[model samples]
Target: MPYIASFDIGTTNAKGVLVTHEAKSILEKSVPITTIQTEHTAEQNPDQWLDAVLKITKEWLSVGIRAKDIAAITFSGQMQDCIPVTAEGEPVRPAILYSDARAGKQAERIKDELGTALIREKTGNHMDGTLTFPKIIWLQEQEPVTYEQTASFLISAKDYVIGKLTGRLVTDPTSAATTGVMNLEKRTWQTDWLERYGIAADKMPEICPADEVVGQVTEQAAKKTGFAPGTPVLCGIGDAGAATIGAGVSQQGEMYAYIGTTGWIAIPTKEVTYAGEGVFHLTHPEPGMHIAIAPLMNAGNAYKWAMSVFGTNTKMSDKFAFQEMEEQMQASDRRTSNLLFLPYLNGERCPVQNPDATACFIGIKATTKREEMCIAVLEGVAMGMKQVMELISDASDYKRITLIGGGSKSKVWNQIIADMLGLEVLVPEESQYLPSMGAAALGFINLGWDSDYQAFSQRLTAAQTFERYIPDPAMSEHYEHKYRRYIKLYPALEPLFETSLDSE
Candidate 1:
């Protein structure tokens, strides 16, 4: 039987998964991508991503899986990147990651020129500095030499690898949407917007459907990646789009939450109306559907920080540190803790758009224990989720939630989320790699193995049982009181963030 190999190129690393027809993940590998970071900027070398794919593919072959057995390859990766490449697909410079907000001035200038209402009407998103188009403008204005020599500015990490594999500089609408240039209604590049910015149309990548076969792997890519020459490659969607479909959440009112290194509450909808600022409307891989997203820059990573700083010691192994922390948190007898944490370690995206926001613990006293502080970290992220859920759903009868990603593995955190939101949380067996599996849907379709994304998603997720966390009715008043307090802290703290940054 043939297999589909998918690569999820994320912020800090590249994760590769080999999936079977039954949606079973047989082999998995991860490699770190070197990041060059400074104040208000984040960048990566695209060659490291290509090297990771090569390493993972060869490692898979070493384990007795033949190169020919791999039927097709696809990708679901980090969106809204700015990677400038030459004519031969070589990187003109480092890639500007989605997290970087150095283009704040450019974003405001774009908004001033085009007007936010017009941009929102065309793109279904707010003009934010963290997006690709603004970063491209930053490049053109700040580094004219680099911008002038660049042939194309790639926006998705996977698109760079695809160009190496198939020599086609193409991207899907879901990925293109993050560029702040794609016309969401037409599902194509809005050349008018690009032309207005004096960005040449030729620099844009070809827009393609997610499920369509773009081209076959070239002989050069074949030699490096250990794949059969002419192996088919697919135009895959963004990680959020993949995760939404991979979790089998295409139907209206089927909402989901992802709490990994980052977090978000997403609802698959048919509406284009802005629920609120920072609520991203991403086009689903399946046509005619849009995934309304309320994004968060913090989640499990905040818990990770707490674990490292407060939980771990030099003598403890990483595994033991995690075990110890879980034990400690579970050991705490307080049903409703008095402490709180603001999980803005890397700043925030929704509810408030401030990048200067910093994390801090509130209600700290002489009596406050480290264990109580750690528990507050989990509760803080849950509180953030609760706020995003209410905003994104917009009282549209959202019943249950499917929670996925690394954070879903937390028993304490999941219960906290369920209690805070009063919704049953379902954590799938394919929690972390769900997006990788979602990329396989297109590969299966290209091979004539599946009819459509919905059918493929159904087949992939139907047999899996989820870990359910039901909300406890008794804790309603307790959490309601806490959430009210939690929401107020951010606003009270927001004014200070600006002053602190200005001083810095």
Candidate 2:
């Protein structure tokens, strides 16, 4: 049986999986990639990603996985990263992460020049500092010497790996769409827009379809990764697009929610559907499909914050922290509570595009208890997701939702989402590997082992059982009322957030 190697280069870690032609996992490995985060900056060395991949491949080869057995390799990575590299594919500096907000001034300049309406029409996304163009502009203004030396600006994390492997600077349409420089309708780089922003055309990578064979493993890469020389490498997609296909969301009106450190609600559409401002529109990994995305900057990380504040003094282990918190949440009243939380710990994306937004606890009083606050955090994130669902529903009707990612492991959170959205939520078995599996599916297609992704996905997910969560009628109604209040808190607190003396 031929094997395909899939890689998912995430914000915090890089995961590798070997899958059979039939899409069964044979072996999996992951290694941490260090992220250098500061108050207004988040960066990671692109070299760290290559190191992690090398480590994973070395371990797999040591365990008797022959290089020749692998048919093709594909990647899925964190989207919207700014990695500037030399002509020889060496990073000039640390990669600016998607969460980095140091390019706010540059983003404002772009908005002033191009206007948000034109940007939305051209790119299908709003102007934000987290995007690729603004980050590149920041490099030009703030670090001119380095920017001048930079030969290419890669967008997605996997693109960096692709550069190192094939010595070709290229990106997939799904990843390029997030760069704020791609013409969404044409699925190509917007060279005119880049020039207007003072970005050279040569600085951008060539765009390719996610399933196309962009290059092959070079002799150096083959030696380093234990792969056969000239093994085909497909132009893979961003993690969100991969996860969408991986979660079996191939049809129109099908939706999925991914809650990692950040969270997003994505739905496949036959045409471009803009869900107002702050929502993202990107090309799906599958040709001719579009994904309407609403992303929240904080989701699983909010739960981490709660655990740090409330679970630190307890004797519970990290693994059981969420379980204990779930028990606490279950003990609380199901109807409603006075406390509400704004999950803007890392600012926010979608709905509200403010980088100055801060996390806060509202409706706190002498009667507020610790458990109520904990449950409030869960509800707050759920309410945030509800806002995204509403935006998506505005564009298209999606009744069933598939939930995937690290946050899908929590039944309590899943229930809260189901109740908040008043929709059926299905959590797939082995949800964490969905992105990798999606990448593997792309590899299979490129190698002619599969005719289409939809059929491959259906077959792969057919045997997988999902835990279903239905909305409680009473709780759904209660959350509907609370959601009204939750939406109001952000606008009411906006003035204060701008005037506050807090400095990043």
Best model per TM-score: 1
Tens digits of lDDT, candidate 2, 311-423: 63566787787778877777888575857899999988877988888999988898887778888898899998888778877523656689998889888888988988888
User: For candidate 1, which ten residues in a row score worst on lDDT?
Assistant: 391-400
Taking all chains together, each candidate's TM-score versus the true structure is 0.97, 0.96
Pairs of residues clashing in candidate 2: none
Best by lDDT: 2
The digit string of per-residue lDDT tens for model 1 on 1-504 reads 678999888776688898888877878888877778785788888999899888888899998998898888999888889989987889999999988999999999999999999999999999889999999889999999999999998878899999999998888888888888889888988898888889998998888989888989999988877899898899887888888877878778788998767878888888886767888988987778888988899987898788888975836886788888888887885474778888888888887798889888888989888889988988888888888887777543865799988788778778888888888888998588787887877788777787887788788878577899998876656888888899999989888887854576
Clashes of each: 0, 0
Superposition TM-score, candidate 1 onto the true structure? 0.97
lDDT of 1 at 181: 85
Off by over 4 Å in 2: 312-317, 394-396, 502-504
The Cα local distance difference test for each model comes to: 0.85, 0.86
